[model samples]
Target: MNSKKLLLYSSVFAIQGLSNAVIPILPELAGEGSTSPAVSSLLYSGYFIGALLTLLPFGILADRIGNLKVVSLGITLTLISGIFISISDNLWVLGISRFVEGLGCGAFFPAAYSMIADWKDSHQSLGEFNFLLNAGLAAGVFFSGMLAELEIKTAINIFTLLAFLSFIFLLRETRGQTPDNSGRKKDEYGTSKRVKPPGEPHENRTGFKPGMYLEKTRETFFENGFWKLWGISVVLYGATGVLNSNYADYSAGFLTKPELGFAISASYLAAMLSSLAAGKTKAKNKSIIRAGIVLAAAGILFSLKVPLLAFFLIGAGGGAAVLGLVAAVSRVSSSGIAMGLFNTGIYAGLGLIPVFGSLFIGPLGYESVFLGSGLVLLTTLFVKFE
Candidate 1:
């Protein structure tokens, strides 16, 4: 990846880091924001739900116009939403602001992933993307925990400031151009090579028409193997959601918020290293994904026995499965819809699993939830990609 690609991926780092920055504070968000902890979690629910609802729509938009415009919009909304969240005393207003912030991030994701898919060694590039994302997530948890010790609002300031900075460069990068495809070169065998041309839109001679876009999107997402990949995505990512949504509450018995933040940071660091390691392997994507599932299951089961090292196993699996999923899904869908649907799989699991699983948490225990999620994931080990 070049400097431009690195910068582009940073936008996601900022968006995700900012969004997740609040997780460390979830246990106490109600007191700080003058609401209940359950309601405080609504802020997270709203964000992922917002991301879920818009994945297809914004994806369509990215496929039509381009990713840069969508990223610009996402960052801009994040900046504006931060302001509202900063001043608001009401939980309802805070939730609303978070929802809008989710919309902004939802906008950035598909376009951003789609952009990565267009880059050189896209598989490795996606790993690099995941690496950067984990780094950002780790930073967010650490800083947010630290900042919350002073004031809850201070934590929000960090990502918001980062968003404002990202938007500035995004505007500068996308100002007169879209992500450029004109600079690509062909090898001796006639394979096209990824090259930097800054950010400029790929020229679409077909031109976007309402009916045409609808037709293309339908054709792109509904083809054979699409739903299968989606199913796998939901299961894998939902497992992740189970881990994250319940993290703070689960850790409360064993660790402080800042200590938990350090643990979470360690988890992401594990994920970063996992992705980097996986990116170097020559194994089939299928094997990689299965290995990820096995690792995730082991990690979850281990957390039942030992919580301290659970982060490493689960985090490593998290990165591997996603890279495998992206590579796998792209094979099934030849058009622009692949990355968007992949993201939908992610946020859907993030949202849906926890919502349903929360019911079980109160009745059974965190162990049961982790056990159930892991067992469900292990069932997919036999699944084969076409």
Candidate 2:
């Protein structure tokens, strides 16, 4: 691969996996701050909230100003905020810093995904991206586990250093590189060779209108199969959130700091393999998606009896489902906008499910939260996407 793609992959691999690292170290963070695990989880929510707010806006910015700029800006933000995270003294500060990290991620992914769509077959390319994503998570988990053996602060500091290094590479790539405002590569003669993105008027190609973005998003919202597919995306990510936010607590006796980390990392490793396989499969999107939901539901249901097996089953199936959703969305709208909206659904589910599931923790017990996720995934069986 070229240097540009390499740098982008490195940045995404680190940024996406950063959350998994944090999950395993929650106890250390809580103890250091003298707070509860419940409070520490709000930090994840803070990141989700920032991602939820900025994805579409950043997508618009990428479409108008060029993806290279947006990604470079994102890398800068993540690098700076990640350093601040190492020094955060309280939940409030940590939340804010995580929020900034989320903003950077929100900006990076759609633009990066859009770029990948142009460089190669998006389906296969997306598979490679997922591999890096999960591989990075596994690496982060191992690193965090090691740091937990010493100090959580060291892990945070190392994480910041990695982000800084990624930023340097990304910055180098962006220099003297300029794509068109519409995010298309120029033809040899210096004119756009690709069609304009969704919702802009042909008469006035002058600049971005803030309102045009909203209109395109609204149009996609009402598209025939969009909401159905969007619902699946929501349920998928919600189930993931259910595990990430609750599994550490639930696995108290079954696993400890790095052990839970390793288990979750194994889950993502299975997902990475599954994603690569799915990309090569000719199966229909609905077929794979339904299979995935069913597989994950069964895993969650049997989790308490066999946690490791359950985690693997859930990750493997969920990987297929996630790729199916992204491929589905890409076909229906402007690539960047579609990806941005899709990400919004993902983080929305991530942010919302745990809040509602937390209620079940008091009455039905903590496992009930995962039970709710299983139920949510089960509901998709009766429905079809597109």
Candidate 3:
């Protein structure tokens, strides 16, 4: 409810809203005479590709420079990319722009989560963040579908405008703020108190060594049951990624564009609600994760037959699972690096898993891909969180 949290949440909502605004209209964006399904897929996945490459580096940079600075830079990139997407009709151009836009997200998330990791009630804060994240996605899908009826590029233009506003607000809010270097500690009341700035001569300052980066990454990945958390992210996100990528086209056979958007939006809405619920719950993180896995698997298995219910289940499950995973990872040392690694797993799943599934769609069919993804989610039940 503080100004900082409000700014972070609002900025996330705008950027994420733009990210999925194009999904329902992927075919139109791909253009006529483009028979290749790959073009449409590229239009959708390019954002994730950009984010996948930059998340970790930005996390490291956030640790050095400042989180708010990276967040500001990310909003700037998103604004630029939104303009590019709005003006360009070329498929390749749009693809590249989407990639750049994703880079903006890659920059934002690790830094933002790093900031959140400094909070007193990180679990509840993360839940609230995730809730807004899903709300943005749902709004993007629903409004894009509604707006595209007026004009194909109308939704893109509108989201770009929102991004512009968010960027301006971010600049005003973060002006004159410097990076905190007290190493992620909080007072008894959960408010952060700054130590000597990073520029001060301190024994702990190693000045961005490559060996230290690798060492911290290795230690973070192996410690505190984080690998299990990372695996859960991969499976859960990968399953949803497969759904997000393929389900639109698959469902097109039965549903109209608006209806398709509604179905997808329903999933995100469910996620938003569930995330809010998860944050307030006292259940163990692992238990929540286990329940989430079951619900998601059920959703994926039934997606082909019951589109709305299936997606809703997936969203609900994903929301809870991610809240648990992120809350768990927030406990590790070097919050920036931990968040970087955690998000790297997310983008890897979102960007790469669908590409992996695409290979099987030709030989094994869409059903195989869905079933495989569902089974993959189920397999994670065996992963020990302790």
**Lowest lDDT 10-mer window, candidate 2?**
184-193
Give residue 8's error in model 3 in angstroms: 2.6
Model 1 scores a C-alpha lDDT of: 0.72
lDDT of 3 by residue, 1-386 (tens): 67568778888888989999988888788765424345666777789889999999887777766666788889899999999999999887898999999999988987788777667777678768877888889989888877777888787888899888887777667553443465432112224434544433212556679897899889999997888889889878888787777776667678777887888899898887887788889998888888888988999988989988998999889888887887778765445678788888888888777767766676777788899989988999999875
Stretches off by above 4 angstroms in model 2 are 31-37, 120-127, 175-205
> What clash count goes with each model?
5, 0, 0
Best-fitting candidate, scored by lDDT: 3
**Model 1 misplaced stretches (Cα beyond 4 Å):** 1-10, 31-41, 114-130, 171-224
> What digit string (tens of lDDT, one per residue) describes model 2 on residues 238-303?
877777776766776777677776677777877887887887899987788888888778778777
Model 2 reaches what TM-score against the true structure?
A: 0.87
Given candidate 2, what's the lDDT at residue 216? 77
For each candidate in turn, the TM-score is 0.82, 0.87, 0.87
